[model samples]
Target: MKKLFIAAILFVSSSCIKVIDPESNYITGDQLASSADALAGMVRAIPVRLVNYQNDDAGIEQCSYHGMLSMLEMMTTDMVVSGYGGFNTTSAYTYGNLSARGSNRGIYPFYMYYGYIKAVNDVIGLIDSETDDTTLKHYLGIAKAYRALFYMQVGAIYEYKAPTDSRYTEYYVAPEHDLTELTVPIVTETTTGLDVKNNPRATFDTLYEFILSDLKNAETLLADYTPSSKVYPSLAVVYGLYARAYMEMASHKNATENYMQALNYAQLAITTSGCSFLTEDQWLDPKTGFNDMTSQNSWMLACSISEGNTDGQGGGFHHTMLFGTETTYSSYGWRVGRSLNRKTYEAISDNDFRKLSWLGPDFFATETHYDDEAGKWAYTLRSADDTYVGNYRLTSDPQWLRNRITVANGFLAMPWIYPGIKFRCYAGNYTSRYPGCATDLPIMRVEEMHFIKAEAQYHLKQEEEARSTLKEIMNHRITDSSYTCIASGENLLDEIMLQKRVEFWGEGINFFDAKRLGLGVDRGWQGIGYSRYQGTYDIDGIAFFWTIPFPTAEEDGNPALQGYNNPYMYNTAMFTYQSNAALSQYYGIPPSYGN
Candidate 1:
């Protein structure tokens, strides 16, 4: 696969060069360099490569950024899946398998980001930075910003920080086993296979420096370039990137300076983006909720998925997340359907509109029908007239409940509890047998910047300012006028994080936040939704399993990484677990509920 990828890169490079002799069908790099259209085409292709490129070697069509990585990241967090059929058997439930070098869980992300980085490098290598062509510079800025984004994501995933580190001591009990600090190898446009063979892992300081440098260049280059679509990075998006990078850096190093910078950039993004918070109507729209980028002004950057362009046969984000839609993986036998963590769901206040994202416990207070022949209990909701409607109202407005949580007929008999209805299908295409997975997934939004600003303020000792910022977003989310944040000190920080978690649930942002803040996984408690066979476990900060190991292929090919690979955590029991009987006794949910 690596060789094939390298060959494809060479082919793309050859095809893009200038065709000096039309008869010969050969082109020179110099000729391709002067064409602004060519540069733009290259820059545009980077997103497609990052989000949609399929790796056939992985034996799954879902080996792309949106299809696999996002879903996998969500699985590691508070997101819970019904343990019926094939869902419990997947690695998402058994996180120990994530450390296996041969596992696609590791390979998919390792290849996806590096593949994107190589493509971005191809574009960056062609542009002459001093050139007077504004068009070329615009493309260059976007490419650099994207490169920084990929590096930030990959670096966060692969780097291993010990729980014993001074930064994390307050949040975690140090694990019995400790590992060295390291990030992935640095690859560039000028790098050769020989260079790769000898390249060692980069230090976190070095990685952070490289990321900031790219964003700095991007910020300057994108100063006057106004983007026509949110798909491309603009000045605001660059500022958001700055905010994100500084926030991540502040997690461990130079907290005072980094958090202050994070706060400034986040405020800049919120003010300059020309985007506003999504009103209740926009957020909960049944047809276009979180599916259409143009439907709301909150989205700053997104990967636009069009019909027939994304994988619709159960590999895309919509296929896995939208249970309300028919023909999606979640709706078909509830095979891979996901639900909100009971603990997290219960944490949300009744007055908060975000709580409506998941079905309430009242939705499960319906009669059960036993299928004698199938030997399973089918859960169904009935109306006052005893007609099967599959509807349950949590609010006085029946139309509001009907619009967001409409379930397919096939799913009416399933026993999945508290399944999330936040991500809806495009155009309310719930009855169609064909998969309508054309939901534009958000990469960055102004809503996130508000949370970043609040967190930064809290870290910088501006407690009152932090409370105001938190209240600003909460006021927009909570319809109740009584809602106020009076918490101070550590409690104030917790409030800010809780709001952020609720706001970004299932969006793949929580895992990074959890890792950076050194929060442990505590899914074994009562009222949680983790499966029994998976066994509820409490892992300390820097869950070693969460730090993905370098793929076996990379280690074997790159000699320098053989001895220096991140620790193999599959054999190491880095977490403590309660017995199956204890878990079942406390949680009360059966393995295959109603089976």
Candidate 2:
């Protein structure tokens, strides 16, 4: 597979450079359909290129999907940036003073996704003109599916144009403003270079209509195609994408029909894909937890790493977010950016298996057994007969706790008490050379379908049905089956959102969910002291949110888009933080928070 990918890149690079086509030089619409091998390589390169887009000549940071996700996850209230010693981009975004003319937070995704869109359009254009073969349409379908997915992502970040009738205010602009007007351009195979140069943002209704049309075509074309890898978009993936889009659309209306559409498509994805939710044991596996191929069975779509792919060495997701990789990669290491909010951590039920995804407050007594498969030492409490209970325990033995917790190399630092390990590097094996990890990133999972279905049912006012659906997923995840949800009214949605925050913790959908639902987040009283943003903000208000701006560079290049930037405002004072004596005892105060 590595050799094949290298050959594909060689083919793409070695060809004569085309001034007209910037993304690919070797392939034209006419030449693309000539050979099966060439066509396959071209299709294969789409995902390879998508995942490999790390940085550019500008001071842009990691722009890969995983990188973008890590950035977005850190912005949410569920996460706390424990330190600011790493990327300045993380620090800039955490401060939430992003300007339309300057911020890389909004700018990098545009660069990344537009590059991908152009590649997909090249393939789609070839197929549209030359091929009638069902096999060829499979590639076309895959391209369209990917295009829809990218458009959805761009729209979610920049501006989500709601249905014209929506009563929801356009987030962060003004009270009366709504998202009826779109801020993103709708690019397709038919869009020429000239069209791109003169592109104007379309209406929200127009963009979504085109997205749905593309998805509908993709679904029909890929109906008989079985994907070769979990990373590839298959029929099931198309259904899942459709369900996700509809769920976002449902937020615009008070009707049950859109919710029903979301529910139905989610059901199709679950049943057609034949995927199952991860068991508690599977989720807690130290060797291959949420970040590797062991969980691929539940993933409808994922990103696969191969030898030909770039390691994204200094700017990759794991390099910046996971501290355990510090032993291997010193230059790209960070130990404090991925801490969990203490309040959100406490909200989780003790019996829930997801709590194991992060480090707990309790310190263990001693260094214990090394599992051969894990290739890492884990502290475990044992019975009198030396029968092991589990991988974790609470210990008040100060001598033992102090010795183990305060190890050299900054291991288990106080502020990193809830170090998030959900998206860490795989144990025992390195996917690439040192500093470059090969852990696969899942894009969509089977458990998300259940959450979508439950949310849809809740919106439709099917309270009992929604409760049962939520319980179905909860029963599989927790050790105590007797635990029941008592949330009603708005609390029901709160419960659903909490489950999502837990399930997808580091996988990266929390901020987007908060954006779509117009939810406010409090970065906890304890957490406000740790965040560079100072405190939480209403996601739809003027203070802080994950909303991106159309960069000034883009505005300067495109004459049609001048003066089109969104409103910008900042809070006058930092949020007040009431000190907690117990928290102060657990973690000592730093010199300065925003430092």
Candidate 3:
């Protein structure tokens, strides 16, 4: 699949920037400058091209930008994917095959992002920058903002710093193999094929400078523009992108000034967006939970997935994350679906409303504690050999677990102990079995701005302000009225990050967070929570596996990437198994469930 995609990419042109279709006659620059509708259509296609474009030949449901990147990002962290589902294809990430450049998962993002970048560049190239047309300026701003967003993702994933660099030594252990700092090559409107052939990865300073410039341009052009849908980039979304870029920049350079910029932009986004946090009822809504972006004021940017338009076939975000839907892959008993790390799960206070997002290990024992009158439990025990054994029905406030039975006669009925129910399938009819994969996925929510603000406040030494910000989010998430964030210093930062982790679980933001914070993957220690393949190993200091290698196709085609690619760490034994205990005991599961 990767080779096929790469072949197609190469067939179009030798350069990544020329991924646009060569066979079709493209509209000339003069035509685009004169035609408002054509230009508007191109601007509209930017988000859809990146987020909603379907590539079935990839043979993975995660072919879309959000789906592919989210899967890859989550797999790199403590998030667990069940071996029983189609997501098992991404297990390479869990097993520390991050350098599998030929693999579909490894190259998909590189292909997708660069392809999307080319499309955005075409729109930008056709438009005259000096034009007085407000609408053209708005269109240009949207294109630039998306370009910045895509570049930020690329830089976050592929950027590397050498051990000799003082900044690298401060945050990470020196890898056994020598490496040099590198970001993806910058391609823009005027970047020709000859220029791309000689394009070397940009330095961190160079890459981020370009990103900030694009965002600044976006900010000015979008000053008077308002988008009707959350799908388009609004002024607030641009501010959020500024926050995102600066945060990533701070992580790489360890600059206090960058942190200040991130802090400022985050606060700007919060005040300007006018988007409120998700109410407790909205957060846990069984029918519309995390699916309907239109009804939720909290979502700042989202992509709507309607029926017949999804990257489905059991591979989309809804199919992989939401287990309660009967039509999805996670509903089957044999599939483990998406589960939480037990350590992280245990960290949440029992009273925290978010704790209800996952099924407790002892859910079977605690079934009676929940109110049945509210239709919380989606399934019930009928008989030992009942046909409805795996059938699940939607209810008003259904909890994580589908059924009540732990053991059905001689069979151990329950499969995943901590499968996530935070992201539920769209439920127009509460009783409908065929919910389909039509859940609208959130790209950015206002709640994230709150988190970004809190962390930046902590880094800026505004301890009291940081605590208040953390408390503000916690007060909403935790049902306890008296709860406060009292942790000071590094612990306070940890509390902020922990809450962020819990808040954005299965949302694909954690991998970047962990990388930026210089945290290691510690899933192999005793009492670890990861199940299956990821349970056996830990990476101390920094998990360089999180550093993705440039796809082999990119390296092969681009002369400048040859011998300068990110080091392949798979054979280095970078990840080691530190525990000798039985797998079941390591996972804290009972011995009856034989491993």
Candidate 4:
């Protein structure tokens, strides 16, 4: 799973330089440009630093990016945290206990992405001064693309966009704030330490402009560059990143023009990369699912997991989310990982292959059963693949026994099981205390392009075109050609959103999408079960709760962030209810609760 291993080298400079980020140091521009090898090493350092999210401060409990995704996923109605008693579990955020000073929550990602930005800026400085070589220009492109991605992610959380956010009215900073009004602090390669330390946050428009500028530069530079691996930014990822960036900016600017551009760039990424949709079999393949990076033609970019990979603070996706153990790593216990809400699980058509990502009543009743002979389920429900079907014996401390029993009892009462088998563990293949949780984490893929294009087309009032595009994605996942999405009754936009929710599920885009579209999350009803994951799924009463709170630590340190944090809104009561009636309507039958 590990790709491009490079030993860390320190580049120290005595020369004075401006620092733009708090974590950046005195590595001078001259020192960075002095050696091409040094610059390349620094470039290599970008991804190396990016993958590590472990903080000894938080007991190495979370990886910044993955943990951010975990919080977002858990807070949404679709994904649920099943592990009730795990240390520093996401349950607090899932139940709407997010605080301005929450430990290992927003602070970790804020520092993580900014730290990445600082490293990227260092590379950009070197590239700007010393790089005329075509290869170096490609590295420049990579740096810029990554910078744009970080900005987009950070901006998505902090900045309030009026078009998408209903609580924009409550924001102290104006959505129409000019270039001088700070939204996110702008730190570039040219930014000096003094300037960075005292820099004011840029306005919403200014932040978007800065992000788009980086993407534009990257797109131009990477156009002809053939990428060595999917882990690095290819020309395709550049385009895809542009498409994603434009989609976010589209609402603020020329909606029609930006949507068209978003669609165009997405198309370019697909056509230029020769990436195709995963076949039905690949979709159903338990061994691969969403985890296998190389085999899926749709994968445009992924994070690699290597042997002895401690990049995730010794916790890979398996530790944070995977429910059952394949290898020796502690699993918290089966039925105690993340889970898709039963209402959301039931919305997918029975024939659709993606439906199998989560286990439902059908899986328990027909496809799998308790192996009385082995005193375990015939297969580890960790993945859908029959090859992965085997007993999961506890080789570690069985202290998790009581909790495991509790989860097992809850599983029987719930309609569907979650923390879906989408991410499979490398059990039989490798084993060590921290054996590579070697599942490749996906960043961008071609399947997303189809969804983005459909959403843009729909927004443009090209309903039929949107339906056609939706059908293109649906046709690949469903065997029935007779299926057609209608523009009536349930509405085409909702149907498209539903498909997106189903497609992206645990991938973490649903939360952002739900917020952008001004859609309130409704997890139907808290089930009869007593599990945390099965509770009432709603965070309604909190206005703008979707906007992540600015870490109090950040505000105290940076004078620029004072009074600019998104206001915290508590859930005094559940906001709205999305009934199973719509889900039943989609499947054309009332979903069975259980046996």
Candidate 5:
């Protein structure tokens, strides 16, 4: 898909309100609905780009398809797998704090982000300005939900520390007293030549606070609202936002409550509102369902794009992160689309169709499903070798494309040529190369709700309820009556957490989950893989919380931000893994938190 690459995005205007259609010079009930561009530019959309910028969730599925490669950082796959040893990321990796709001090409999008925010504010202001009293209440609620959603994502990925407490001085972004005068922007020598903006990243506390305010107001507007808003935001979508926010806060109880809410809305959207999961056949076949996100199964999608459509591009991230496993490529070599870890691939049962989508050991011709007859299953196979081997696409010639062969046992298996499979659909009309390239980003889903409820019930000691919840979610995948469920104490929580990590494989939730649950990034002996971000440091040894080593301390330099840490940072000497202190309350920077 052709990406929209404009030079400079306008910041939120202080004096003039450039409403979505200040040009139309008129008002109508469909003002918000009429302009999809205006609605899309809201704060809700910025994080989609930001998450692409932040390579937090790489070893997962979504990235393999697209959006995983160079969302934020400029590094290549080799550089990411092996860190460039030094104080800073080795030259192998890309990204040098393009946080500042300006234009220089790769970083220009940052300004465009604020411009979108400005558009959202414009719509919001119009809603407030309208004297007609013909309220676009539902649309307004959706706008608020999206605004908070965008900010939440930016806060998590860009901000160094969580704003557990906005007043904490260590925070990267906070609303501070201008002191002697109106703010003229502050970089404080700490973040010098990088041209990266400081004082902009939102802290967890402030970010969540912003989210809560938006959500509360949204609830008020959404109380009598229906689910017939735009495809991007809805009641279920708002709850999804809440589910994510609470999960980040470590408020399992609240998280559970809201995730269930998300599921209910999802079901409502599916059965009544028109949305549902794609049939197995739609797996890697982008033409049928991958891009048609409004289907009931869609809990959340970045935005749908179809083959050959300009809107279909998976942004440029696919080319940057997902490097394939030493596979032979036509020309550009095998620079993009990496292979999935065998362990992760192996975890799936043969019956689990999704697992089959990725190329497995038994290599054959390049087809996976048979064409002579109809096929049905929950899993659809994604071609690692660009051919519809499973009789997926009815081709004119038999030998031209890989065709599935039926065995005596009556089971049809797609012949596989390569060892690795690429999940991303190639951009059809836009770019002939990556047809599996999908653009919509998933932030939440029903599967996530199931896990959220399970976690909540477990904490409440509602063992039966938790079991039933987990069963409800898992039953769809594994129906064996004897399949055991291991969930109790840490096991139950761990099971819940693991399920989330797996379900959200590429949706970008792992790193933060580890911090909220107090599970350090280090899996120790369990995780033998190396991290590019670790450089030569003891990444494998140290427990990685979201703790950004003090920027002042790091050679890259700390960028200034607005607010303080919601919960203050502690000195290095005072740092402790175990803390009875409420996370929202602690806010002092530890004197020795240097990496």
Candidate 6:
């Protein structure tokens, strides 16, 4: 998918500026409101490029065999369309990279939130700068909420390992927003250029204190105001944000309570937003088929490419899912959607939606939406700077033939191209190419909310209620509960986590949920893994946290003294092994997660 449309107007300043001149530039009240909105949108945007693998106690999971993207590929490969280029790698590296930088990943935050901090601070300035409180409190509330959110993401993914105990320490802090700089840190306070380094890191206490303050303030601001749009952070998202913050603190008592608070807010969001769980009939709708038309269920979503969402790069209907098929884009350049391991592959029920895969005799033009916009997916001749122009064809590579031909569905192209089951947005003609037309990316949905509620209740031993909730999701999602497993006792938690993992594969919930619950990723065994929209993958090893790239390279040779780039390395001999369990053929994983 083309994610380049989030609308950050990047212009090279004559030189980086530090020490704000109130006259030269300062965020205003209106800017504060606008930036608050942008902050929400950017939060959703940050994760698209990265995946978290923490498991709290749930087993951790991740894919690190591939090299870091932003650090290397952006400087090297023109492999964006392949879904394995700089963007993916950059976002994927956000956790570690930002941590090393003493900040959040990518320029996304700096680019999106500096303006935010400015906006909020400006709002505060506006309140005191002016007379009546009026809406200033409201906007202030929003600004604070957004501030807490960005900090939470930065804190959880970047902070030094948990104190091993939550005794507040410097490690727990999120980088402080140079509020005067707003979200943009003044060069004086920030490391600029590549090698400068020397920016201050916020202590864990500082980060949490700020987050708590914001959420508490936001709760008051939101007390009476009922937002007309669910897209905005209704009270629910605030609670969700609070739960997220508490979890980062490892304050289970608080975290669990906040999670429940989140659920309440989620429920409110549904009522106010008109969102609902995916019904059996609407689970995989074709066009604007799914009930994705902003409802209470939509905690977050990138607007459809058709609807003008610039959130992802070249919206490609999430083509990275299907491996071994022409329809799946994993075959493009970067080798994503690599085949699933035997264990995970075997764990999938033949009846499960992900196991199915297909290709046609040749690619076609059936996909009208993507191709029409695709300059080429539409088959327009290359005007001039055509990289593959006259250089490749549907028949040019046998890998093409192998990738294109499928044994199922008469091996015929739909309309004219291939389509994956879960991700219905087609990538258009195999002969011609363009970014695929996937749906507005989902941030959260009733289905997952259902699972969260189910799991949370289960942990509290709301056994029967949890079981009932779990069944509601399965039956509502599939038409039959038989498709799901309902093991109690030792495996109950595993059962709940697996349901969530398979249900929300590429949507970005897995790693965090797994971490919070202390569930173990099935490097093998039943929870191994599967894919439909993303393609198959055997669990290589259970990685709980993203080994974010050490942006030492980006930070080196700079006056800012930005980061000490940490290489992506894990010593395997130290990993624990399930001595009695069998390991799958998929390589790189050690027997178990270890200290």
For model 1, the stretches where C-alpha displacement exceeds 4 angstroms are 1-28, 34-36, 58-60, 75-77, 83-85, 88-94, 163-180, 310-334, 366-416, 433-435, 571-582, 588-595
Per-residue lDDT over 1-595 for candidate 6, one digit per residue giving the tens place of the 0 to 100 score: 1111112311111111124345545443345335555444333322222211111111112211011111212111011111222223333221122333333333232323233343344334333323245455555565566667656553443333321212222223332222111111122111233313444445556667777887887777766656544334545556556545544454344555655655555455445445566543344433322214442244443223222322222322232222213343444212322222333333445454443321211222222232335322222222223233121122124343433333232221122222223433333222322334333344445565566666666655666777777777766544545754557754776677666766754344554554344343232222221211111111222232332332343344332424322223322222223321221121222113230
Candidate 4 yields a Cα-based lDDT of: 0.60
Candidate 4: segments with Cα more than 4 A from true spot: 1-27, 55-64, 82-88, 102-104, 161-182, 311-313, 316-328, 332-335, 365-415, 427-436, 488-490, 524-530, 533-543, 571-595
Give me the runs in candidate 2 sitting further than 4 Å from their true place. Answer: 1-27, 54-58, 84-89, 160-181, 294-296, 307-314, 317-327, 330-333, 364-416, 430-436, 524-543, 570-595
Compute each candidate's TM-score over C-alphas.
0.83, 0.81, 0.82, 0.79, 0.56, 0.55
Over 4 Å off in model 5, which ranges?
1-116, 129-139, 158-203, 222-230, 251-290, 294-296, 306-315, 318-334, 363-439, 479-482, 522-595
Best by TM-score: 1
The TM-score between candidate 3 and the true structure equals 0.82
Error of 6 at 246 (Å): 4.4
Ranking by lDDT: 1, 3, 2, 4, 5, 6
Each candidate: how many clashes?
2, 0, 0, 15, 78, 74
Residue 352, candidate 5: C-alpha displacement in angstroms: 2.8
- Candidate 5 global lDDT: 0.38
lDDT per residue for candidate 2 within 276-356, as digits (tens), equals 988875676645565565554788888755534334333444432343322234323343345666566767888887886
For candidate 5, what is the TM-score?
Answer: 0.56
Ranking by TM-score: 1, 3, 2, 4, 5, 6
- Model 5: per-residue lDDT, tens digit, 430-517? 2243444433444455555556667757766777777777766665555443435766777877666654554444444554454345
lDDT of 3 by residue, 1-595 (tens): 0001112222111111224455463444674557777667666666655444433433223445556566555544457543243335555565656653544566566767777887688778877788788988988888898899889887777777432323233444444444555678999988887898889888888998899999999999999989977878889999999998888888767769988999999989989999998887887776677778887799988766555443332333333233443233343322444566666777788778887776654443322222357522222333333332111223432332234323331112233246566666667432333344466777889999999999989988999999998888888887676667789899999889889988987666787787777666655444444444443455444465667777777777788887777766554233334322343333344323332
Write the residue-wise lDDT of candidate 1 on 308-412 in tens digits: 553432344343343442223343223444566666676677877777777654554365555668554444543434332233212123333333233342222
User: Who is ahead in TM-score, 4 or 6?
Assistant: 4
- Tell me the whole-model lDDT of each prediction, alpha carbons only: 0.65, 0.61, 0.64, 0.60, 0.38, 0.37
